[model samples]
Target: MRELVFALDYEPGCNTVADALAEHPAARVRSLSLHATADRLWRVDHVTGTHEALDAIEDAFLTSDYYADCLATEDCGATQTTRVLDRADNTLVLYSDWERTPACDSVPHIAQDNLGDGVLFETRHEGRHYTWRLIHSGEGDVAAFFDDLAGAVGESAGMEVLRTADTTASMRGSNGTQSSPSPEQEAALRAAVEHGYYESPREVDVAELAEHLDVPRSTLTYRLRRAEEQLAKQYVAGRLVTDEASISR
Candidate 1:
């Protein structure tokens, strides 16, 4: 198996959800599950943001051509349905089903058409960038697919390849049995580190980071704390396991 990782940057008005994400820069979407056939696609997505941002995103999804039935109403031979599976103060889970037609083309459709069956997809959307990870049997013409997608998107979107590698090797290199951080936690952690929030002198504080990220102080603090706790636990667990193995040897 092979993994193809790529990212797409969408301009405003190019993609409905992308536009919404651009408008609400702090909001993020991560695909929890996705499956696509020739004629249909089903997905479950987890989103995180402020309440206002989530509300706007939900509205865009339900009313736009991306996740709702607008195409069917327009007699485009396509149908879509979406609903909120769960909601919290700063998080939302959405489920969507789409019956595709030639008139409506999506990333999943393009990938399925070019990569063939048994391809697994993982995706993350933040701001105007959508990143994808595809696991396939390495039988597809990746370069041709990339060109096709680039032409399909035209000038409204930009695409780039991030990585390509053996799926098995990638899996083996992953942290063993450690729960990975969620999108929100990972974003916060990354931002904190980049901004020197964890430096000895603490170049930036939580409130300042929150302001820079445009999120509430409480939300940023909570995310940072959770991320820190998770990392600490993982480090200790790994050390203990290593020590035990050394003693046995």
Candidate 2:
């Protein structure tokens, strides 16, 4: 798993990124996501199919201020971080802004397509720069090995990571061994269910939600899905949805 952490100077516009990649017909949109805080700094993480294609995408890529910063962190290796003792309050996020979930061989495409994305919000722990990252790419999974890494980081810090990840996909009903979430995640889960956000809002322009909320559309989606996950914990307890949504089936 190649994990790179850097900062960007632009806003997150996945559609633009998608359109940019679409310029290369052979390359298709894989997955795109955005993370942000009120401070205005933006993180856009996207993975797409390899073009056997773009000869100049890299040129267009590294030229960006964001990509430039990311290249500087190539030497940073937090991929195999193990636990010594960790923090319980620490939160990790699985930024799965992928499209196809490519195979291992396709990891390169993921790396290549996401030229300016994959920013990790991390903190230093015992001298090592611990980060939230993926262990594998293009494994046909939208939400990849986030929990394992979170656990690893917690163990390393000698404290259990309670949230595991800041954003995660909870089982609607019986997906993992863990119990459901607390009332907070539970309420978010209920809102998600009542709003039809999880079943894929038939006509929801998710981007629009951001417009209304005055947040980046990416932010809306993240919060929306995250809330869904919280509710899903209840759906988990209550046996909502179908077996299709359960990872433990």
Candidate 3:
């Protein structure tokens, strides 16, 4: 399968949550999922740098043009439910449902038209642009999807294809070799080491690491453990191969 990652910028009048995030530098929408139903539901997961920023986000949900557009589209009824996942880190998770509305011109709808069963793995809002990671069955589908999306959104809104790669091949080195540590694994290991996660004094904990990586704590911990296992296995394999060669000689 192929994974195509791209960034799409909303037009000036096409207000979206991304636009709301652009207005708050201390806030970021980490991930979001849209469900197609009688009431179209959008589950948004986000992190804020401060309580004031969090309050601003809640206010935006109520007053932003994004929700107004949804309400205007097909006489949709809009409602939102929010929860505090982590008060200390300022993480907020919310679900917004637009009842009896047509699909908003959003990334999820674009993927549905193009990729069929493609999965949207990650989404982040930076400035006025929203970056999306989608996994498609093939390259051709992605290309077609891009064309269709451009046609739908018009030329005024900038669309940029940032990166594309085969899911299976991306994790492997050249010539199908298994590298000691994958890029993500290496990054997790480096962060852990640099932050003194391994030190007796423990300069940084798993929560801190997760915050730094913008991932869940469990995710960061899993990657670090996987990286350590890979490094250990590589060392043992190398030693075993050398010992066998010496014995033969």
Worst 10 residues of 2 by lDDT: 78-87
Name the candidate that leads on lDDT.
1
Candidate 3 local lDDT, 1-249, one digit each (tens): 887766666554455454566567547766656454333445556656467766666665655433521413222334444444444547666555543335445455556666775454576665455666777677347667788777756654567675577878755633233365656678889888998999999999988988998864534654676577767766777787789999999
- Model 1 per-residue lDDT at 150: 77
Candidate 2 lDDT, tens digit per residue, 1-249?
A: 233221111222311222344344333222223332211222232223343323223333323222211212122221111111211222211132212211111222333334223433432111111123332233233223333323322332222122432222322223543445544335444554555545754333544444544543333443455456745565674564456568566
- TM-score for each model: 0.68, 0.30, 0.55
The lDDT, on a scale of 0 to 1, for candidate 2 is: 0.31
Best by TM-score: 1
Ordered by TM-score, highest first, the candidates read 1, 3, 2
Q: Tell me the tens digit of each residue's lDDT in model 1 across 177-202.
A: 44556577789999999999989999
* Model with the higher TM-score, candidate 1 or 2: 1
Tell me each candidate's RMSD, in Å, in order. 7.0, 16.9, 10.1
Name every residue pair that clashes in candidate 3. none
Model 2 residue runs over 4 Å out of place are 1-46, 49-62, 65-204, 233-249
Clashing residue pairs in all predictions, respectively, total 0, 17, 0
